[model samples]
Target: MNKKGWWLMLLIAICGIQTVRAQGETPTDAKATPETLSLYKNLLKLQHEGMMFGHQDDLAYGIGWVYEEGRSDVKDACGDYPAVYGWELGHLELGDAYSLDSVHFDKIQGWIKTVYERGGVNTISWHLRNPLTGETSWDTSSKEVVRSILPGGEKHALFLTYLDRLADFLNQLKAEDGSFIPVLFRPFHEHTGSWFWWGKDLCTVDEYKALWRFIVDYLQKEKSIHHVLYTYSTDRFETEAEYFERYPGDDVVDILAFDLYDRGAGYSEALKYCASVVTAEAKKRSKIAAVSETGGPIAQNTEWWTKTVLPSLRPYDLSYVLVWRNPWQPASHGAFAPYKNSPDSEDFVRFYNDRKTLFQKEVSKLKLYE
Candidate 1:
């Protein structure tokens, strides 16, 4: 579709209140690229969006640390609702195998394998420090480990080193055919904002583009990491073109996504902005979009979040709308935590319960696993 065609279709999609009505028929029988088909298959599963709950370790990895290990809390929280069960892997840790020896490595591998076996979607996001300024080292291990085992470089070299090390680990973890267990891998996320060292505000677009292309090229050609789907995610950009401008193109990305958080401030507006941006991008690129990560302080936006934000995300090609953390707090509003005080443990429960039917219907329509 041309840009004009995409805009017209987007206008109709937004103005039209009947979201249940599917958009005009496209050529379903025509062969779609693996990325295209995978996105569509996942979108169909999105009717079950509530199945995926979001967790962030930087704020509260405690819950995620337990849940990923098969603790009862994950099941207890999501028992009634089928979910994607999302978690983020650290950037440097991507190079560090969770286990060193073969037996221990297998255990870590087994955890990941089981999650995929259960249709769990894992997104590994990493933090890259600029090695030029004498930055960049592994967080989990000693400097020697990063120096001896990890790849290092200056400028774009730092970013490429992380990617190269990760690609190697992914190779070891994959099946003999090189197909990864189906998990969503999102690298270089939140680029529109500057909180991270790699964010656009910190680095020039040309530099970001170079780093992005290098990672994608090395993965697809040199490493032949075909099973891994690369997603380009940004924070809520200030303008439409701001969002579109950062899109690296379909060649480098399989899924398009964003992460947003609210502390009861502009809850409705944030969702509206996201809905507009995601729908436009999805149509333009012929790709799937997701509110890959979001949630409010369980205390702050309990009512609005469960009612407004969660339900509103259903209309678009939103496959995974996840809750940030299990607990609540005032200070939690930053990234993962919405606040410091726990007001409602049941906030998530309410969201899960309220949206259960919608999720079930979406999942049933998509037949996600197949």
Candidate 2:
């Protein structure tokens, strides 16, 4: 929809989500497994606080620690970490694979456990490659991957095997006490964007919904993997309808979120609109909401941390706002988060110190996971 249409819808969404006798703040029992009850409670508690921050590869690895494991972007900058940690399951579904930078598929499991042990939250996304042709995720050269991954198709069995490997990896995320580590696992993300193989143009609504439900079922019910909170996310969606266009169902989704970025000069408009939609939807459904991904060249925009970024989030009760990784040698132009001695370092320190934003020390002290 156009920008004007989106704003009009946002007004209605705000009314429905924040008022008009919607369900209470408590989620209406999303059928959580015993393993995930406490985790869901923690998410609800966080929603009330609306104070959590996350960084991708914060503890597992970063640009300077390409060869080393157990490092963090936040730690390098300010001797602390974020409350939530974001990781990717790319290339790991198929063993012996390499990342986009050709790094071997290793260390992610250890990192998940590390974050869990530290009483931090773990959220994972998958840039899964095409199961049909073994091409990259954005290689939309063919439209058969989603179809074939469904039941009774050419690659269906292979997809199951891939999932089997994925389940194995997830099952291995454990604390030192042998308890399963809970994670917010988001799959087939950015469906609103057409760059990925699973984009809106490539599949019918039924096809996409089926694929999401099937994966959730196989992993949770069939694989007996209950330590996961399945999340539904999109990128830069404007309206409520656009947000739910490809949503599988509430039964299969635990968290409702969206990713926004400073793609151009000012993204504050889109960020506020998307956050309103996401927050309203999550509240209407009694689920948690988060800014799954967002960042910009903080180093270039010295005031980005407090001025442009945090101000846009002053509206609602969001669980977390996770920025992209801080690249030591960015193939792109800029760093998503500030690093030590970076141009935006002082602003970032102030942003972290602000009581509104929760860092690892604040969240860890809560022992939300325990």
Candidate 3:
């Protein structure tokens, strides 16, 4: 049988009998039962095993990069996303390029707060820079710094400085109800890969674990910060074992997410890898799983995504999938050189619509806390 036939048969096998209710069962059914909602909440607390979530490093740059100037363009760019996902987690690259001054901090805090006020979730992460900024001199003890994006070494001392400031900022932003929902805090993500300064070269598994434990303890105990769900994410690595090995552990991790891109590569293999590594790990941990980032070169085919890629991932118990917009890329292909848009965006639109409908259908069977 062909792909469509195979999908249909699988659908029937899973939900055909399950969909029917006994006599006198009426329509207008709530998505899920309360018990199941509780179960989902408990399961989702694992963080790493939820749905695919969206990503916006582009927005981060646009906002944080020339933050000294009033970043209208940056604000405008991020404004585009609230219509689709209702939430976005921005990656703030805190290198020599941007200072952690009031201008930078206030701009980011304002942007995130603005989105949050508009009924969207906004969060941020920063990449730790290599060679430690401005110092091989490393502050041996926790000292107040405008921002701390240190690359490994004496991490406990360096990170405590950063976390102290972060916790202070977060506390200031708490809502009237004193709760911050969906604070997607991630540090040391994508460590399995070689690009980052602190990648495989920077530390051993034991060191990674110790660092994670220290951060979590400092954040929760000293700061009274309970609202954040820390994510353990990695770039799709050479093998699943490599991916699994970097996991910091359940005590320190609240979410499991992965970054994958087609990058002129085949979508089929990408999706298969996602299933094998991300999806399988999520199920094992009973954590939320997300496709944190994805998009392709502009010259690529969109049909594969719309018809094949999008449709292929829906059957999995996924939480969210976010498309990356690199300003360098558009929503669809055009004459611009090195354009970024999936080749088959139209198909993606159609596929997204259909999958959303299916999502609603499945969601209806879910139980809620109410």
Candidate 4:
């Protein structure tokens, strides 16, 4: 071959390697399905585009509404659905028909399938009960709870049964073509806070890491369920070191995320700082980053969406930011995203129109799983 031809082939080979590397790191599960891998790659690419918007329990129930077809608070407020949808599996461990939020497990299954079919992303968080006390996740009266669920502990065997129930539900998430739908499974989240049983004050660093690794191994290796992308998230932290204090190794986590709410006057500054930290760490590790959970009372601040939330998040390369759920009762103050004709609804529409944000109509064209 000529010298020029030989050099051309070498350049082509180098470009191919760089292209693959740009798709981001392989998921922690070595045996992850093809769709899951593609989803990860597309999510990484999305960071350069814009942050996708997400809502918790968007399709299940909204303020003054429940089980309504083709209805969503986000869509009603902004004229489009969010790019990502969040679901909870709190009571699945106890073989319950409904979640802790009173949404039926069967209804969740249907909603997940609908989101998948519409080319949207789905993320699941577990607020499981404390196995030792048989109380809610917030009942952190005992610090020994984490140790009891570890290997050789008194509740070790029973914990395995809980894992079995979780694996069963995950394994059944199939599309119309029988292909498994990829989900971002975020278990034991917000460990930096002492609110849950697995919080930092309730367990040693080693115990928390062990619990995370055990769940990943059990679901991927033992149960052969490989359609999930594991996400690790914290509540709030002032520094990168504080964020990773309880983080499991990269081998067991796919996305690096943090959860912060709009509490008071310093919310925007704090949110910006946390977003910068998470995006930098994710870039160094070649992983996806996001605000896994965020939002507060929109009624209090009429300009919260455009002035506070948008400016805080616009500077980062994060993949998505999800607001909490809007309850069914009108008197409830837990509503995060604005509902139809709410005080902040106009501001939310302006936020939606920003080029730096991507909603359902925009994200669907990305074909993330393909």
Top candidate (lDDT):
4
What lDDT does the true structure give each of the candidates? 0.51, 0.77, 0.46, 0.89
Give the CA lDDT, 0 to 100, for residue 160 in model 3: 58
Candidate 1 regions exceeding 4 Å error are 1-40, 44-69, 72-74, 78-82, 91-108, 134-160, 175-179, 325-347, 354-369
Candidate 1's clash total is 19
Q: If scored against the real structure, what TM-score would every candidate get?
A: 0.69, 0.88, 0.63, 0.93
Kindly give the number of clashing pairs for every candidate. 19, 1, 36, 0
* Model 1 lDDT, residue 142, Cα: 26
**Tens digit of lDDT per residue, candidate 1, span 226-304?**
5565677888766777775666666666667887766456766777777668756766765566777666554444555
lDDT for each residue of candidate 2 in 1-370, tens digit (9 for 90 to 100): 7433443453344334432333443322344444466667666666665468898877645656564554566777766888898887788767755555454445667777777777789998888889988988898887677898999989999999889988988888777877788889989999998889898887778889999999988887788887888889998876788989899988788899998889775598888888888888787787889999988867668989899878888777899999987655757655677666778888888787665677776666555653
Score residue 185 of candidate 1 by CA lDDT: 70
Mark the 10 consecutive residues where model 1 has the least summed lDDT: 141-150
lDDT tens readout by residue for model 4, 165-280: 99999888999999999999999999999999999999999999999999998888899999999999999899889999888898888999999998887888899999999999
Model 1 TM-score (2 dp): 0.69
Report residue 57 deviation for candidate 2 (angstroms). Answer: 0.7
lDDT of 4 at 203: 96
Q: Candidate 4, which ten residues in sequence have the lowest lDDT sum?
A: 10-19
Candidate No. with top TM-score: 4
**CA RMSD of all predictions:** 9.3, 7.8, 9.9, 6.8
